[model samples]
Target: MNGKETYDKLKEMAFGEGIDLFRIADADCFLDSEYEGNRPQDFLEDVRSVIIIGSVVPNGVVDPLPKGRSQYTNTLMAATALLRVASFKLARFIERTGHWASIVPNEGSEFGYWYADKDTLRADLSVKWAAYCAGMGNYGINQLLITPEYGPRVRLTAILTDMVLDYDGKSMPLISDACGDCRRCIQVCPVQAIHEDGTFERFKCKEYMFSELGGLRCGLCLKVCPPGSGNP
Candidate 1:
């Protein structure tokens, strides 16, 4: 089957399970060259297309502490579960078509520096950015992918396949500057990690996550994001 037909079939599968699939040509997609090198052969072997999926976290699930566990961590875990299912389904579909499909996680590849070298790491595109590039959504000021339906409250997962697929090329207006005059996310940051310019200080956020007492994590940014606040 051609790229467009393969993509259509995959879309139907996703819809059957109530998941959304967005497609973009693997070659045309731009990733962080620093983490993901320009050498396509290194990370992806004959990757014809990339399938991006978004999972919306349910509202009212954000809590600093619930009983003894952190609610934010629970939500992330839930999102991870959703991604796993979707990716596996897509992989199987692609394999059935006689093409190799691999579900690569956002984290570094399985192979050490040799197969998935550090350069590939630098070139690795941010999950949110990849989703946006795939025409799945737009970029939010907090560096999160904001879907029209889910806002910045979604987790992204991807599937790489040799199966050719129709490209969406639909670029959404970036909202990276949406914080324009508003700094709600910054003002509400418990660790004060969010900068006035809407840029996040990763070190500050990481420290907060690593040093939090009782091991409870915080998703202040995710919680404060107004998009997924209401049910769709």
Candidate 2:
């Protein structure tokens, strides 16, 4: 099947399984790795499209907890489960149709087949960013993708495939700035990691995550987010 047909089939399968899948050409930011030498070509030789999937974590699943317990972990696990199943099904479908496909987990030593560079030490840009680039949702001030219906409460996964897919390029530009100059997330940040320029201090965020603050990996920014403020 052609790109569009392939994308349609994937989308149908994803939605059928309660997941949202967005299709974009490999040119999207997620697929481009020129800045970090993490290009997609290093992995799948015939990669023609990326299937970005997003699962909204219900607000109820985001309870703030002490250091040892993480609601983020729980939400991520839930999202991962959905993505894994959907990805497996999609991969099988593609293989049955005579194309190569694979499901790349968000966490791993390599991005598909590309090995990490020693000096850079950068994992693929956050999967959320990939979903954003695929036109799945808007990027919130908290550096999270905020969907119109789910706000900043979502997890993302990606599937790499050789199947060419039609590009929607239908991004929600109007959903820009759900934060809206509001520094609630910044204000709530105990470490003041969020800067006025919209940049975050990675070191500071990391410190809080590992510190004895007795919080679940510092999800204050996420918990305070009014959007998607329910159980996952």
Candidate 2 lDDT by residue in tens digits, 60-159 = 5555432324556556566768878888898899889988886656531112112323344344434555555566777666666666666665666677
How much is the lDDT of residue 204 in candidate 1?
A: 58
Candidate 2 weakest ten by summed lDDT: 107-116
lDDT of 1 at 39: 37
Clashes of each: 14, 15
Candidate number achieving the greatest TM-score relative to the actual structure: 1
Residues 1-232 of candidate 1: C-alpha lDDT, one tens digit per residue:
7766777788877767656545564545654352342434457758766678766666666533333235656666676677778789989988987888877564211111112334332324344555666677775555556666665666666777776777776466666434456566676667887776546665555556657633345555655565324447
Off by over 4 Å in 1: 20-26, 31-42, 63-69, 106-123, 213-215, 227-229
